[model samples]
Target: MQITGYKSQGVAAAVDLVNAVTTVEGDASFAALREILRVNGFFWHEFEERDAEPLRRWGRTLREFFDAAELETAVSLLNELMLELPMHPHLADHDPHGLHLHFAPPTARLPHRFRASTLMQLSELVVQHGLGRTGTCAAEGCDRVYADTSRAGRRRFCSEACANRTNVAAFRARRRTPRTPEGTG
Candidate 1:
């Protein structure tokens, strides 16, 4: 399934938050959190000091969602969140991105809006591609998560660095292992 930039940002933002909160201990500082929002189109000015801890906690919750081993488990988690978060989905023509779906009403607090956006984006992802587009990083010792937003959907690592690190390790390991004689039975 093709993922538009509109859907991808929220999902990518969720992944970024999860990695910030989980992959690096003590990394989800307010400034760092605000930058995540800015990078994802949430706008740093929209961020409040009060929003940090909640976004951190939400990041942890989303990590659980990405870590789920079964479709039923992931769906159940999302359903529980949907029951809790207020979502007022509507059409909007907004600055930057024009004519797109807005998951939260304009009056909602930024944290609430962030929650609503990430939740609905994830729900849409599950609907379109199940668990195929999200995963834990394949690199050993890495706890980061990733959401594949590209049309190819072939991603297995959270970043290009992780991909290169893992690939280099695999290549070196193969080179070090003794190859059996071609005629050996």
Candidate 2:
């Protein structure tokens, strides 16, 4: 729940995977998937062709949490996955992230490791913050999702581009609206 830096990687990797597989413009190709793992500090080298279907399917399934509109709905989905996944929680020490918890068993394959980590981290996030820290992007036409693991956790959009676009649109809308004179009814 107190995850920070790379220690909070599962949250980020979940977001990335969800976006990659769920967004219309996303690249869910094999290479793209591998890059996502590498960028998120997962074991990209171990990724196999056999892992693709499950990982892609997991992304589709995990997107439900981000799309959930109620705490009960999100909690139910996460709980179901938690019960299904085979988790073996243990401590690990490694570069770029020091000591932290690893949820998957040591012998688990890359995709299963990903699923366990993401599922546990997401469960922890929901437990700590309910639905406040993850959601679909607020931009008008974006389908991407996001998870906010930062201390402030004030995020609402998935990216700065969407944020800036929305802000600029709002500014233009406000400027276009004719304001009544001061004190006018």
Candidate 1 per-residue C-alpha lDDT over 73-104 given as tens digits, one digit per residue, 9 for 90 to 100 = 99999999999987889898888788888889
Show model 2 residue runs off by greater than 4 Å.
Answer: none
Model 2 residue 91 lDDT score: 88
Model 2 agreement with the true structure over 1-185: per-residue lDDT tens digits: 47667657888999999999999988889999999899989989999999988999999999999999999999999989989987889888977678888988779899999999988888888878889999999999999999888889999999999999999999999999999999995
- Model 1: colliding residue pairs: none
Flag clash pairs in model 2. none
> Model 2 reaches what TM-score against the true structure?
0.95
RMSD (Cα, Å) of candidate 2?
1.3
Give per-model TM-scores.
Answer: 0.95, 0.95
Candidate 1 ranges beyond 4 A from true positions: none
